[model samples]
Target: MEDQTPTRKNNSYCKRKIVTVLTATLTDVAQQTRAAAQDLAGLSTDLKNQALESIAQALEAATPKILEANAKDCQRAQESGLATALYARLKLDATKLAGAIAGVRSVASLTDPVGSIQLHRELDTGLELKRVSCPLGVLGVIFEARPDAVMQISALAIKSGNGVLLKGGQEAIHSCQALVEAIQTGLAASTVAPEAVALLTSREETLELLNLDQYVNLIIPRGSNSFVRFVQENTRIPVLGHAEGICHLYIDQQANIAQSVDVAVDSKIQYPAACNALETLLVHKDIASDYLPKAVKALQNQGVELRGDAAVRDVIEMDSATDTDWATEYSDLVLSIKVVDGLEDAIAHINTYGSGHTDAIMTTDDQAAATFCSRVDAAGVFHNCSTRFADGFRYGFGAEVGISTQRMPPRGPVGLEGLVTYKYLLQGQGHIVATYAGEDAQSFTHRDL
Candidate 1:
């Protein structure tokens, strides 16, 4: 306790200097990524595919190192009392790593999303207008505890002709560094520049990354509701991502009891840590007595904790669910159950409490399924299926950067199609605007070529 004032002041000054240096470094990296992305936007599909293949091979070669780094991260997270769901996402085993690599190769095989013509029209003689697809330039992707995203995003960015600046959560820093290193190594061996993908490991870098609107074309955040909301509030760049995963599954009276039970269980327990995992169960009142018991038994056998409303509790014994349960995204093996009078009531409950992520209806009745699929205001509305199926890879897009619950064009699992924007390319043989604005202008033909 001997006069610590000078030491504290010196430490504060050093911290300020370190932060300034980190900020400068982040800006430099953003500039490099921006320049690389401009070049990437014009690469041929063949060259892009070659780069993806090389990246896949590089990931395969670095499996051991990546796995070791992930293990270190998992251990550190556990010691620091990280959340169970995040810990689950942080632990990257061999199978997961291998699958991630395979996904990179799959992306290479899919059709390139760049330069596809969406429209071809002739405004007049020798005047042509073409709308062509193009990359969205540089993407700033900030995610938590999913190191394998490095591989997926890298592959997609290269294939779609965009650069990416990845900012992974602190818990997975080691894993992310290892993955990005391998990806850059792979890029160095191919036509693509290694700078096309960059990683920001420090927590302070996130705010700096968000401020780089001039360089980053879009920001995609993946994490908890509060974290995503924070990014959205603080960033000037357009953000594309969901804040919560309060998804639900409704079992209609016409649903096959066995099939409904299986789908319900799978949706909840298959991968509870995922954003599309079922958080609530809205069972039709008529089928509650018959379906709830079986569903509850199956879920309980798999170590799932059940919470029930009054009607649900009357059918099966479980913990009582409070009003807050309906809106919660329990990214764990815990589910809330509610009993509804019919299909309409179930839909109402989902629309009221759901997170607009993915909601499903289990029913054999075509009309009921149709109604639910049409009316549910979620990114994905499934009929008689597990919510887990709402994924980019499952939909044959190879892999996803993230799932978007926004009410725009990319309003689901965002894959290659979601990563691109379109540009209108017009060609003219010395055509002038005055030609179309004159009093004696000739009647020009507006025709599709």
Candidate 2:
């Protein structure tokens, strides 16, 4: 079959027109954002409260339109013969739609991070220093077929006082466009700019938008490793997101066998297609004789294809696992198994091959739990819990833009706080630097909040 994917050259003028629309749209959004930030900063608590309430209601009102748009995307996805996994991610029903609306309301209930003072200090005779949290300006988010991501990021950006530009997968274009329209309608009624949230209409437009680093303060790519890497390589703007989640569940020697089995099963098979879901199982050598067989059998019963190392295959009936299996994120009913000497070996294996998204340790010993949490170089290290719990809504953050594996300001789930940056606010009474330069300078005392 001939490829039907749209290209820039196919419709050069249309692509150019979309870029122009984005530029003009974002320019106006930026101006309004600047003004909104100032106004929101100066507003009384009562007014801010009122705005939040209105936002919640507006999102509630837009639910039916959101669902209708998502239905079209779902229909197209089914017709295109897309992979089952991709189709599942692209499909949105009543539950997901309601969750999206609830996510916006949850964000509205959270304390606004804008204008909140983070740090303060006195540098000299009269120069006062303060670091205040502020919007990160225009945020550009490139993501895959999940339509809820559109609502999650939009609400977070608005609450944090920042503008956003979204580029979703072409498969979900109709759904995304519908979601954006609802957001625009909501913003129109409020003090926020309608263009504060814009969506890319086509893939060609997205490629051009990726290069607009000067206009966008940050670029957050949320999808598969290949897509994220592509965006990272092509864009000059600082990209924040995880490449993959080759997460692990380490069944330590000190673990309770039943509890370990439960955690391991839940982490891998409960929701295998998510980034935080377990991809590998590491069992301690001391417990491998008994633990490995039981865990492997349970996983197999759940329709998981278990690929094991030499030690693991020797103990459990499993197919041979290749070297690449150890470094892969199956994101399906597939798992890799390895036998470790102890905690040291497990930690080393994870640090070397794991994607640092989320990893877990099943142990009864407190000291072992502490060691596992400290040594595992992952965004989330869980003890006695499933790696699947490494989600924004689960963490009580309302919603998330994506799970960031980068070791930066937003390491774990990128939520409302992740959408903001800090600005240094200095207050002074016209004191000159010349006064504090001499030998007899006054000592400064900084007060902590």
TM-scores for all candidates: the values are 0.94, 0.88
lDDT of each: 0.87, 0.77
Clashes of each: 0, 0
Per-residue lDDT over 200-231 for candidate 2, one digit per residue giving the tens place of the 0 to 100 score:
76666566666676677788887777777777
* Error of model 2, residue 395, in angstroms: 1.4
Q: What is the lDDT of residue 155 in candidate 2?
A: 81
Model 2 residue 233 CA deviation in Å: 2.7
Task: Give me the candidate number with maximum lDDT.
Answer: 1
Q: Which ten residues in a row have the lowest lDDT in candidate 1?
A: 1-10
* CA displacement after TM-score superposition, residue 8 of candidate 2 (Å): 5.7
TM-score of 1: 0.94
Which stretches of candidate 2 lie above 4 Å from their native place? 1-56, 123-126, 439-449
lDDT for each residue of candidate 1 in 1-449, tens digit (9 for 90 to 100): 00101111111111111111333367678787889889989889999999999998888998999899999999999898888998998899999999999999999999999999999999999999999999999999988888988888889889999999998887888899888888888888988888899887666677777788989999998877777787788879999976798999998888899999999999999999999999999988888888888999999999999999999999889999999999898889999999999988888898899889999998889999898989999999998899999999999999999999889879899999999999999999999888877688766788998
